[model samples]
Target: MNAMVQSTVPASRTRLPRKERELQILDIAHARFAEHGFGAVTMDEVAAAAGVTKPLLYAYFGNKERLYSACMERAGDAMLAAVGAAVAAATGPSEALRDGLKAFFAFVDGDRDAWRVLFDETLPAGGELARAVAEYRDRLLALVAQTQLELIPEHSRERAATEVEALSNALLGASEALARWWLRTGALPAAEAADLLVATVEPGLQARAALRDRTASPSTPDRDQGAP
Candidate 1:
């Protein structure tokens, strides 16, 4: 009788535990969101893709907003955790930045599709989606800005904070664009891409710092005096 009952049960019908099922749904939803953007991807599609019922999806995620938030949260958590670990392991601010960059490039190189899913323009047409995207980017820039603050010399730290923050933001934008270009070219390795970024930006920041000091020096004539 036990053998007969076991034979009658289909393996596909077995219920997956809650955590496992949630992961499966997220995996499918991520792919759908990547392909169709959040606005176009319906809960029904994800449920069907994951072989789960609509009610089950709702039971786990409440609604599309929460579901999307959960997905973005996971990606953001993983990214920050990796970058944080790399930065924490470094002995100095420069090494911290280098480690963070290496981790970032390595992540994208290893999982381009995952990176695109997080950064792509397929977000649902809602304020929630906008907030989600902004949260990821803002946190990332915050990390870099913090690193910049750490790198400043003690005497200049107070006055340089604002400029460093602005510079960090610019660096983040430029690096994002450069990484996309590197992806297109696909010739340089991830480490090389990071090395190139550090080499280029470090000197640029130094030059800007030197210029600021020169312009602010006491010997410099006031521009209003026409001392050229």
Candidate 2:
């Protein structure tokens, strides 16, 4: 049986909880920072956008630098989650690689300004923010190298190892550059840009696969004498 209870309740409005408010502040702050660049955004601007007082903004984020850092962290996490989810769902290396690139481009499409802050070296200078972005990039490169290694052919282990690292870095740089170009020219759909990237990458990946196969050792058949 389903029971319904009724109570005399007031309809007073409630403010967003502190935790939610902080997230709201961060979202607005991230957009502002991305739109105006780090230096051009201010606490008051963020506060106004957030519909909060400057003091409230300060209470949550402390300062512009900290706010910038928070935005970077959020953007990086979002980007990684998208790529990681795509990679996890893929059944094969080529598909995984393609999906990862698509996820990355989708992220850039959704959060262009945030991606700019995280990828562009020209943003807020020096200190922890720069260090965080550098660390994130390094980690992303490592993941790319790992993914490439998985796609490497067994016969060409040595060459594949050397080439995958280079290819990974090249793809990373090219994706970032292409995203920036897309932002500037608005010439291609994000999917088209990702497809173009995949086209550039596939030949090298095919070479790696071919090398592995060519170098792989053949399995031996059982002798007629016994199955030992």
Candidate 3:
């Protein structure tokens, strides 16, 4: 009777494929870190949440820091890919900025936790992890700078590079702030939030483009008086 009862019961755990298991662990870890921040969460908590042994978690991710890094890398890479693809598909500078912002907000809206993981302020003040995060930010900044530079004519790009980079930094900062606010308040839909940002910034961007265009174009020469 005892043997029969034991046979009837299911095992506590089932083996998963390696990639599947890794992804599962990452998803759980990502959520935990996002909710509690890296400093407060523990491997045991994540292991329990993931229904895995602590040894297995360590075997897979090596340590808590590594697990955190993995989460950051995944979130950051996904965000960059989404925004890059959106920008690549755009027909013009304005479209690129608008599409990129939409893609960014869409990503945050789809997974607010992932956005938190990517931009967690609780990360160590200075370390390899912080450096890694900075590298991701730099990559994003470069992408935005390139997008901003697109608004300037090719001939003016060299001279406008500094201003474009500054504008890119400001745009990224504003977007991050707005996203956090959106997450906190839920005041606007993702598309509308993106549109609001676009509306606020596009006029200035267009004005800069126009200014550069005028500056770069040679002034029209007056026709010779009384000459055919």
Best by TM-score: 3
* Between candidates 2 and 3, the lDDT winner: 3
TM-score head-to-head 2 vs 3, winner? 3
TM-score of 2: 0.78
What does candidate 3 score in Cα RMSD to the true structure? 4.7
Provide TM-scores for the models. Answer: 0.81, 0.78, 0.87
Which parts of model 1 are misplaced by more than 4 Å? 1-12, 124-126, 209-228
- Poorly placed runs, candidate 2 (over 4 Å): 1-15, 154-163, 212-228
**Overall lDDT per candidate, in order of appearance:** 0.81, 0.80, 0.91
Model 2 per-residue lDDT tens digits across residues 85-190 = 8888988878888888888889889878768778765675678777888888887787677667768765555766777778888988988899889888989999
Q: Per-residue lDDT for 60-145 in model 1, tens only?
A: 99999888788777777788788888888999877988898888888888767667667766665558777888888899998888
The 10-residue segment with the lowest total lDDT in model 3? 219-228
- In Å, residue 112's CA in model 2 sits off its true spot by 2.7
Candidate 3 residue runs with Cα over 4 Å from true position: 1-12, 220-228
Best by lDDT: 3
- 28-47 in candidate 3: lDDT tens per residue? 99989999999999999999
In model 1, the clashing pairs are none
What C-alpha lDDT does candidate 1 achieve relative to the native structure? Answer: 0.81
